[model samples]
Target chain A: MAGTDTSKEFMFRPTPAIVLCEPQLGENIGTTARAMANFGLWDLRLVNPRDGWPNEKAVAAAAKALPVIERVRVFDTLAEAIDDLNLVYATTARNREMFKPVIGPDEAADRMSAHIGAGQKAGILFGREKWGLNNDEVALSDAIVTLPVEPAFASLNIAQAVLVLAYEWRRAALKDAPLPFAGDEGEPAPRGQIVGLTEQLGEALDRAGFFKTDAKRPTVMNNIRAMFARAGFNAQEVRTLRGVVAALDRRHERPNPARLRKNDDEQ
Target chain B: MAGTDTSKEFMFRPTPAIVLCEPQLGENIGTTARAMANFGLWDLRLVNPRDGWPNEKAVAAAAKALPVIERVRVFDTLAEAIDDLNLVYATTARNREMFKPVIGPDEAADRMSAHIGAGQKAGILFGREKWGLNNDEVALSDAIVTLPVEPAFASLNIAQAVLVLAYEWRRAALKDAPLPFAGDEGEPAPRGQIVGLTEQLGEALDRAGFFKTDAKRPTVMNNIRAMFARAGFNAQEVRTLRGVVAALDRRHERPNPARLRKNDDEQ
Candidate 1:
């Protein structure tokens, strides 16, 4: 078992237990554990794993997800694996004849979030790596969960399937939690910085004969200002642009290459 | 080249390209191709691949994505590989020092759809296996795309990253066939135009000494490129910028504002 970090405690939340039925390879189980850990899923139940439990190959493949591998529980039958869960979703690639409610991972996650939020245990049942779970095994599940993969290549490997499901489950569970990083433009720069940039660039363009005529200066300047406004530069970016104007402006004056480089470095 | 089915033509549409930079293992490349094919993505570009092209291991591991593996394009440099792409998103696991907009997979997919729908090329860049994209590599991208994984297990291998992005892209493109709103930014400037602008400005900056040293030139140019990419300029904006560059470059061609006034007065 790998050391667990209590500080990173999202695993303690009500996440759906991952149940693999008749999983063949220890590598799949280990990778499945890795996928689960990546999305903060913890509970792992195996119904008749071919290689049995506590497999070293599974541990080696699980990487730093030892907390998930260490806590895996093996069961003799599909019924036993999901016995304690109040709700279960059976994931399958191919369309089945059974009249179960088929739902996508997002909806499944939402339902599971609601079910687990109400203090009822829930689990997702996945099938074998080769041919998936038998009809009887799937019948034990409460509903069907399928990914929206292309019809031509619908099948997803065990770990890949687990990854998508776990990702959605965590997303649903943390509905209000903000993304790890905000898409900030650094407060959109201060209005004064924008004005300063516009004035400096407007003056440079004026001297460079970009306006063509003094009468056309206002309209052209307005267009240039509008374009800069449309770009929505941050403070840092405004500073960079000012440096560009200054560098270009210096071309009309003395050609001091060394001093120009020094000025840019200081900026 | 692997035989492809014309019937599976979702790959033909304005789909985002999948680019892997310095991918170490052929197995990962093959599985990434599989993941792309599963979600109907066909374009696969490799940059400076470690094992060379047409690898047997990649073909063996690619499962049913023979078409993708067959049509793989390899480039010696990242810039060359992404030269034709109008918009590029670089995937990174860790926080970066730059100010490119950071978005999740879903948002990235939506943005890609909007860009591609407007008749512009878009691509997602995946980095190496051991460490992700370097700062300079990321700087060439229009934006930074990150996943919503547990921070403790934030990193995803090449194949997994492709799977998530490809899955979201398919869902955004197909499932939501009718976009909520039309793209307001007319068609964005093509890659050639953007590259031309960058090159022309870079030369002007070089002569003007915006870069402090030859060693610092790449970093400064990358920052400049990233800033323009982040602006998401349209064709007209690019033209306006080219004119600005030409006007700036004319500073060495004698004082012309007085001559321009005389010509305007004569008109």
Candidate 2:
């Protein structure tokens, strides 16, 4: 995907398998599938779906993500679901008080990437729709995947939970994922241009008697230079600023230029 | 509200105005509210929902989220919807030709948090569920919030988009959301303790002739010391490691002390 107004293509990569542990609603499953597809995640394993397999409702809600829905795997238990996976992360917001390593989605994604890079199968286990993965379920996994959601409302909809994890996985796994960016408006000011601009401004300030306290002159001048540096001046911007400085520094003429010239002539 | 299974309360904050531009489905709106509420976001505005307001279907899908649903506002147009907001981010995946800055949801959330902190209102505009915001609508926004969704399936459902933005906003606002944490099992080793450990290890290593090349002894020892520094060894860990080193270096109590005495007597 190309970010807005840029030619850079965001490359897709192999992502971790998504395992839903006894998900209840067909609609939630559908939305979760859609979320995964959004981030290029295809492998989906379902552990004992409440309503049963080949759910038409889920397929309908999935809309354009039939490919994921069609290839969905059904397992009777969590162990069977993740048996093939070398590393599994249990997704839960509940503080189970178990002595398990808890990690945010980004770190999990990074670890998963490393595992996958080593040709090891990796997957993330999303808990039930209602209560989430139980303590036992959480204990079985290598790490606990949690988001810093609001404590008052930590109950993220299953699909949203999937989306957040999937998004982070995309951010970490896909090195070339197009990040939102603004194209540069103009060329950066060259060293010569910046030096010229700085000197011209310094000269103008000198004429204005800006450095009245000569003791602090260097500090003030340095501050002005730092301000310009932070402004990210382009070549054109530098030229324009220099022109403004020159105009302000221009010595004033008499009321009438011709009359002033005549007066000078008489003098 | 307390996070799942945690005593810590998730404090609510004033978030950006969530403006949905001509959303088609009532269910999607309900899900959007659910997503927003998951992250403590409450402000929701709709511009010309295809089905009229007070939709039963939307409320049903909201899953008992009446607080956010009840306070939802309706507008006739996009301009009216965001007129009260100071900064606006138009959520779009399209590469529209515009000079506006394009930022990801994380940066947008950061900017929104900063704007709201300064008492300036900010809002994010979500286009229709189908075609997304038109060029004119996108042009009016101060910036574009785009996600790197899979190009094959770039159409992220409206609720998914809202949840992503809301998630990021929550992440920015709640500085205390338990991030990925490495639970330190023991306290950091004090400088004095580390120095002692380093010297002890160095002596034992020296006795064992670890530094074979005299010229590289200092460099090798320094490298070993730096490795420990990088390990971030806690006090307990350092002590345990020291015990291991002492066990490995048990060169005293000659293995044949008792055996040799018994053998000498037998002789």
Candidate 3:
């Protein structure tokens, strides 16, 4: 009852079933269930698991994935397992001479999402842990989904493979999921604050005889104002920068009175 | 030298370093290594692994990830671990009260790719297995990367988290990886073949008295031709369809000469 909220959220949203074909290890099955649970995928179908159904080893491995394990449907054959699904993507590690469209995990997720959105049943087929999906199993699928792993070490553990697809599927389902939190930087400093800071800095620089000539004063002041405007500083940052300018101006007044007079003379 | 081709492919391409902070389990580190290797990532840094470095358990778990494990760098602290990296992303499962830009794995991967492409170092900081990264550790990161897992079961294994990020990074790095194989459907049937099939079918339909009225015959024939054109039949399909028509026509001839005479009388 405690974790039923996420399950409720997944109720109406059409999700792709993860069908494992002839999976050998129960631990692999359990871990795959866990990975599926992590990303909100509940439907898990097994086609002739070697260790058989109701495996204690799988149950033990599936820590908090009881719901997924509880609903696991074991079938005698791959066709029977995916009989009701309208679309199936067979995942493979190797390239065989087949005339199907092979796609990466991201695009596969997107396609699955669109298919599911259109009220069509969709699922992805994963093969055995050791030998992988046979050519016959792949031929049964509508398309092939492959991860872009390094060619030398492309083999992924069964659970790891499920995790990547589940993650992608969840992301695609969410469409443009907003970031969890955008820090409290709220908004940039308003124009009034920026203008005030710019004018204050201008007066301080003028007092310090920073302008070499009267003719260039407006242009230099405009450039300084433009710099402040370009920084896109938040309120806190603007306050800190203004404080820094005031501190420097104070330091100039206290440390070099003769230098200021000389600069004024030149001006 | 046997598997050096993939490493050569990664020579100049910028990749993200995987930095695990105070990872407690050696097996997790090992699996992380395997996952990184699967995705063409080699740089691995550890901030004081609990069981110490050069862990036998880790080595045993990393099946074919010797390169990643052998090149593992251990740092005294998180700062030292990420000190050289120009961009760092801290991965978290929980939504903390921090004010950083929280991004999903895909966007994070793209940003890291761009950062690395600009000749700047980038790394992703994964937290401890049990507790995860502290606020201070997250603060050091330029942004936060969170996976869109089910809220009820948001906890992901350290290795699972690494796999998702590594998978995303590889996909983003490749920009647009061609699918492993596009089945050889060859080219669609040539227009000449289509025309031949259409003419054969049209002759068969005319012989069968499918068009009842003389005035509507042209419109019905045009519709039939348009239907064939819309089907986009390939060479094999066109041949099969033509054979089907010929079989039906042959059956019609054998069935009854009397029925043909009756149809002719109606026409």
Best by DockQ: 3
| Better by TM-score, candidate 3 or 2 | 3
Residue-by-residue lDDT tens digits, candidate 2, B80-115: 988889899998887675655678887898899899
Clashing pairs in 1: none
TM-score of each: 0.77, 0.66, 0.80
- Give the lowest summed-lDDT range of ten residues in model 1 chain A: A1-10
lDDT of 3 by residue, B1-267 (tens): 012234334332468999999989999999999899888899999999999998999999898687798899999999999889999999986666665678888999999888888889999999988779989999998888888777666668888888999989988888866643455554678999988998898888888888888889889878888898887777888988999999888886586677889999999
* Residues A1-267 of candidate 3: C-alpha lDDT, one tens digit per residue: 012235434332468999999889999999999999888898999999998999999999987687689899999999999999999999887775675667888888998899898989999999888778889999998887887777667768888889999999988889776643344544788999999888888888888899999999899988988888886778887898899889888985486777889999999
Q: What's the C-alpha lDDT at position A163 in model 3?
A: 93
In terms of docking quality, how is candidate 3 classified?
acceptable
Candidate 2 lDDT, A28-73, residue by residue in tens: 8898888888877888999999999989889988866755787799
Where model 3 places Cα greater than 4 Å from the true spot, the runs are: A1-12, A180-183, A194-233, A236-267, B1-12, B195-267
**Better model by lDDT, 1 or 3?**
3
Computed on alpha carbons, the lDDT of every model, listed in order, comes to 0.82, 0.79, 0.83
DockQ winner between 1 and 2, please give it.
2
